[model samples]
Target: MAPEAEPRQPPVDPRLWRYAAASRSFFLVIALLSLAQTAAIVGFAFFTTRAIVDAIAGDDLTGTLAALTGVVVARALLSLVRERVAARASARVESQLRGAVLDGIARLGPGWTATRSTSHLALVAGRGLDALEPYVGRYLPQLVQTVIATPLLIAAMWQADAISGLTVLLTLPLIPIFMILIGLATRSVQRRQWETLSRLATRFSETVQGLSTLTVFGRQRRAADAIERVTDDYRRETMTVLRVSFLSGFALEFLASISVAIVAVAVGFRLIDGSLTLSVGLFVLLLAPEAFLPIRQVGVQFHASSEGVAATRDVFAVLDAAAAASAPPAQAAAPAQGADHRLRLEGVRVRDLPPVDLEARSGEIVLVEGPSGAGKSSLLQALLGFASATGRIEFDGADAASRPPSTWLAWAGQRPGLASGTIAANISLGDDDMPAETIQQALALVGLADVDPYRMLGVQGAGLSGGQAQRVAVARALARHLRGHAPVLALDEPSAALDAAAEQHLWQSLRTVADAGALILLVSHRESARTIADRVVRLNSAEVTA
Candidate 1:
């Protein structure tokens, strides 16, 4: 296969300001700090040169040494302050970007995330953004220093000695030229390493998630070998990035050292011939290296932060997608929110499925029944805004697509979808207050009352049996409606894992909830569901019926 194409990105993405407001303030603070730091560099160089020359000439040295000491202390203090500021800014930017990425994912909906790798997404939000510390704390500050200090230091040197300044001005461009040439190679290798790491994480996650199935088919060893191969690829790419970084660092150091040496030779020759004063020559010599220091460090920091730069591109892509998705349609007016219990669908067609229409009001149980491949699940998904459909769906006369499902609908899918937490926490998911009475009522409604509310569960509700986990999921959905968070409940195959008695009990409890004034849309293949359902919506490949 041909190599993956490297994505071109700017040194500093403009989107950081838009998505992470902290970055805007960070830039302003960094600009102010860079100005102070530039002044400190000039002061320190001037004072140190003054102190050295005064001692050589047998002049009074006390005042010059004191001034030099003060300048040294100020420079160190400035550096400490800059380090602290960079650290704080790095943390704030990381947090802000991570939040925006998660919110963007929510805005894009499950349909979008379902198409992307969960492992890669986790990496981006977790370790990927965490890498921004070096980028923000070190690389960015050095960049600001280079922009501010390099020119001014050169100007100071020119005022002291013209020849040294001119030499530096001419040769300063060489470091960046070499940096640009080497940076291109560094970015390519670093991006490849980043992509390889993502692939390795994804492969390992998939292997662990399906290890049981792999072992059943005697393919576990093959899976392990595949993971190892991807790991090796990551290791090789990382070594390549390291090699390029080392070569670039050496090239920059060599160029800067050569340029400074030429300035030193000229200064020494001019002084020996009595054409230059010791004070002036010494001052220019000191400032010459300071002029080149910021730019050289910029190159080194760029290599150190290349991984973070690559990750930020991934973050920006997600933020851009969310921005695009959130842009409201020009002709469509905003939906006004109000109290209305009626659920309505008009010509709602999902994928290749035929258009569907239905209406139900409060205190009604609508059972959606169909054979396999009949689009029953897709219908629920379209209503819940998890799937795209071409038609109008309104709840209480407000467009369903315009609002999040949690605002008006509570839902449970075939999977339990539980995280590691207590049973009460699972039932009251999203409820900050965790009302105990409501938790007890919901558990009783779903016949999980005997299950302790405070009992802890493992990942994916591991402690509960399949049927118990399914019932707990049902209770959680019911609890949302009971707690007045949503007015409707959408359940898909909640009884698929239950025995006949439990299934029948679940249908009766659902009927009780419906009688108490909450609308319910249930998808089930069980015939017993129809007995309690006030209305039945039967679906087939060709059409839908009520």
Candidate 2:
């Protein structure tokens, strides 16, 4: 079956610019502050050289010390301000980027997310975004300040001494020339390293998630061997990246050092020939390295930032992939306000899949039974609005797509996610205002009243039996019922992990719920489930038999 065409994505680069624009004031302040700091460093270097020359020429020692002290203090304060402002800007940008990534993931839903590895997502959110910190806080402002200040510094040198200025100006291009050449060489290497890292992360995550299964099959050692191979590859790629990075740094350093030496030699010859004064020679010599400093610094920062740029490209790829847009329907109907919350999937067809029309009127139990690999799960997901489907799904005879799915239905998966928190927290799932008595009653309905909902459960439902996890999931659905809306409850394989007695009790509770006019749809293979269902629809090989 051909896949559906994805919705057009917004341009990622433009979105990045928007993110920067959101913190425009903060960036402006940082840029101005960096310039001030650069100016102070230049000024200090100039005056200190003058002070030395004056002292050597037998000028007053007291005045020179006082002036030098002031420069030192001012430079320190400027450095502090630059650090504070850069830190603040980096933090703000990181926060914004994280939020944007998460929002993009939410829009992509399970269809897109299922194709991605958890570790890859983790790296993007964790280390991938961390690489951007230096780019935003340090390199970005430095790049801006260099563009503004370098020309002015050149003009200042020219005014002081044309020979020195021209010499410095000529050497300026060499630094960037070398930087650009090395950067081009390392570009592919950086990209390869990022790819290798993502692959390694994906492998490690898979191994961890399946560790128990590997142990059960006595293949744990084999899994360890596989991880070792992945790690070795990662290590080799990392070393290659390091080697290229150091080589690039060495090239930039060599160019800048040669440029500085040439300027120093020219100034020395002129001074000996009596064409240049000592103070001006000293000033120009100091400013010569200054001219190439920003360019060289750019080289160094680029290597630090290359990983982030590569990661950002991947992040943008995820963001740019097709997503379902939340466009409002043209003829939207108001949400239903009474107990007659009938849910219906009429003539609904998912792309490249067989058509199935199903309905769950209020107070009815609909059983969706299917052979393994049938589209039962897909059907359930469609009713929950996870996947886009053709034709109309309605709530009380109104188009279901007209309103959000969460407004009137509760969905329970075969493996519902649990976090590291109290049972009540997992049940409430951040709906903190749910009354304690109501939570207890919901647990009681699922036969989990003996277990305290307030007891702390470790990560991923640790310390809970399979039955307990199923009951907790069931409890979550029941809690949704308390929202004062007769929510259409859809369960996928609710009896997969439950024992016979527990499964019977659960089915009885579901029957009771259905009897009370709450639509219940259960996906199952058990014969007992069919007994309680009002209508049983069997699906085989993607075809539904009513």
Candidate 3:
């Protein structure tokens, strides 16, 4: 099958203005600066032409020379101001867009992210958005200058001498036409370069994550070769983009130089025939290049900022998807108040899974039991609002979607989700000012009383063994419940890595919490879990039975 074509994108994306307020302000500032710069260009050219003609006529030239010098200085100052504004705008707009992308991802939830590549998202958020600096700084200002200055300068030239103005009007369209052709080629190679970079990131992340497995299977060399191949491809793609950029720059310069030369030739002949005065001829000759400057620079800068353009396209896709997903906005389920938290799921279905109906209130131990292929984990995900499903889920008589799960639910998944932090910090991840006593109690409940709470850990709890990490995760969930921060605790195979004694101890600890009025939702395949459960909810082939 042929590869799908990329979508056509506009030069200035409207979404940037909608999502980032800074872009709108930047445009306003740039327009004002562009107007001042245009005035300076006209004044400088007129004064310089006047100075030359006056000198030939042997007129005193102090005033014209002074005015010309001032215009030159003003022009330089304006350029500096434009640069500062563009730099600030680039930083602000990049920050705004990055924040919006992150918020969009949050609104889309974990299920949306699970289907996408994490490395690709990281690229978009990190390096991809950073590429926007040149686009916002140099390209956008030049584009705005072209819009504001080009026509005004052309009119000035026309007022001075119509033949030169007419010649410029005819030739300016050619630059854009050439630019369009070159841009098509440039975008193709830049896109390949971007995709190859994403692939390299994904490959490296995968390799690092599974390095041991690859080594055991004797596939490490092959994985390294694959990464090398992608790197080479990326390097080639980059070279191709650079080649196109240089060629386009040369083409634009050549066109602009030729157009100005034509205007100069016409002005020279008119000056000789005495149809145009010396002042008029010189003024038009000078303004001719000024008229073409902005447009040519715009063409050049467009190639420079092409990477940012591609990145913005990806950013906008995420923002658009999130907007579509949350049309009219989502009112999460209200938190259950003052004890008596009740979770009710009515015909709740996750993906293609069969509907699940369950009602559990505070102080109950509800165990989720099922075979391997059953939607046991999916059901927990539904309650956590990570997965999309068609169903009515309520907590304390309010729509469950109206509130976040963190307000009422504490969960420990199969993976510990530990970061590089002290044990106390990991256990009380979301809670603030957790007492040392409380952390100690939580550790003891999970059979880790001997472990020091203040001891630091490496990435992903690297200092701990498998069973220790699992118990630490459980303690984290239990710590939240113990602090009364959440009324319900959800653990998926909390004791999977624990030995029999540790497993039994963890179950007894859970029973004690439930007896003290905390609702527990446990998913386990082991038979020992049945001893402490108040109810067993079995799932098989997506269907749930109590």
Per-residue lDDT over 1-546 for candidate 3, one digit per residue giving the tens place of the 0 to 100 score: 999988887779899899889999899999999999999999999999999999999999999999999999999999999999999999999999999999988887897788788999999999999999999999989999999999999999988888888999999999999989998898888988888889999999999999999999999999999999999998998999899999999999999999999999888888789898899988998899999999999988999898998788788889988777665324343334337788898998888877889999888999999888688888889888787788898877777665566777889999999999899999989777888899999999999999999999999999999999999999999888877778889999998999999999999999999988888999999999999999999998846899
* Model 3, total clashes: 7
How much is the lDDT of residue 274 in candidate 1?
A: 99
- lDDT score for candidate 3 against the true structure: 0.90
lDDT of each: 0.88, 0.77, 0.90
**What TM-score does candidate 3 get on C-alpha atoms?**
0.74
Q: In candidate 2, how many Å is residue 526 off?
A: 10
Could you tell me the lDDT of residue 198 within candidate 3?
90
Clashes of each: 0, 0, 7
TM-score of each: 0.75, 0.68, 0.74
Candidate 1, residues 68-156, lDDT tens digits: the string is 88888888988999999999999999999999999999888886787789999999999899999999989998998899889989998
Q: What is the model-wide C-alpha lDDT for candidate 2? A: 0.77
Q: For model 2, which pairs clash?
A: none
Q: Which candidate, 2 or 3, has the higher TM-score? A: 3
Candidate 2 lDDT tens digits, 1-546: 997753332212354665445457765786677677667767876788878897898988687777778878987997788777778877887788777777777766664576678789889988998888886767666676677668867876888889878888887887777766777666667777888889888888888899999999999998889878888887887788789889888888888888789888989999999999998988787777777777777777777777876777766666555223333365543334336667777777766567787876877889988787677888878766677677788877777755556556777789967778888988887476888887898888888889888899888988799878878987887787765433688888888898888888888888887787778888998989987999998877757777
lDDT (C-alpha) at residue 163 in model 2: 83
C-alpha positional error of residue 199 in candidate 3 after TM-score superposition, expressed in Å: 1.4
